[model samples]
Target: MMILVTGGARSGKSRHAEALIGDSSQVSVYRYLANP
Candidate 1:
């Protein structure tokens, strides 16, 4: 499964994404992709 979170800067996108993943029961690994 894959999830993409996009929003304005400092809008808690990462935090929200992490929460979703943390609440999941089937997620085993996480890879962060950032481009600046």
Candidate 2:
């Protein structure tokens, strides 16, 4: 499964995602793709 979150900088998307997945002892690996 995968979730994609996108928004302007400092838009709190990350925080919201974390909150949505809170209280779960599951394993989640984050993959970051940086464009240079």
Candidate 3:
């Protein structure tokens, strides 16, 4: 599933994205996509 999140700078976008992920292993993978 694709979740598109839009917000201003320092709006907790990354933190929110991390929350959407399941756990630690999932985090590494998703963080890659989230940041890239």
Candidate 4:
């Protein structure tokens, strides 16, 4: 599963991603990248 969230800092990106994930056991690895 893959999700792409693009927004400014502290814009609920992580929160939304967590909600989308929602206790899913399949998603074993998680990664985050920041670009300026």
Clashes of each: 0, 0, 0, 0
Q: Candidate 4 versus the native: TM-score?
A: 0.59
The whole-model C-alpha lDDT of candidate 3 against the native structure comes to: 0.63
TM-score of 3: 0.55
Pick the winner on lDDT between candidates 1 and 3.
Answer: 1
In model 2, the Cα lDDT at residue 24 comes to 56
Q: Distance from true position, residue 17, model 1, in Å?
A: 0.5
Please report, in order, the local distance difference test score of every candidate based on alpha carbons: 0.79, 0.68, 0.63, 0.74
Each model's TM-score?
0.65, 0.52, 0.55, 0.59
Residue range with the least summed lDDT across 10 consecutive positions in model 2: 26-35
Off by over 4 Å in 4: 23-28
| lDDT comparison, 2 vs 3, better candidate | 2
Report the C-alpha lDDT of model 4 over 1-36, residue by residue, as the tens digit. 666877899898888777767777675455677776
Full-model lDDT, candidate 4: 0.74
lDDT of 1: 0.79
List runs of model 1 lying over 4 Å from the truth: 33-36
Lowest-sum lDDT 10-residue window in model 3: 26-35
What are the runs in model 3 whose C-alpha is more than 4 Å off? 23-36
RMSD vs true structure, all candidates? 1.9, 2.5, 4.9, 2.3
Distance from true location, Cα of 34 in model 1, Å = 4.1
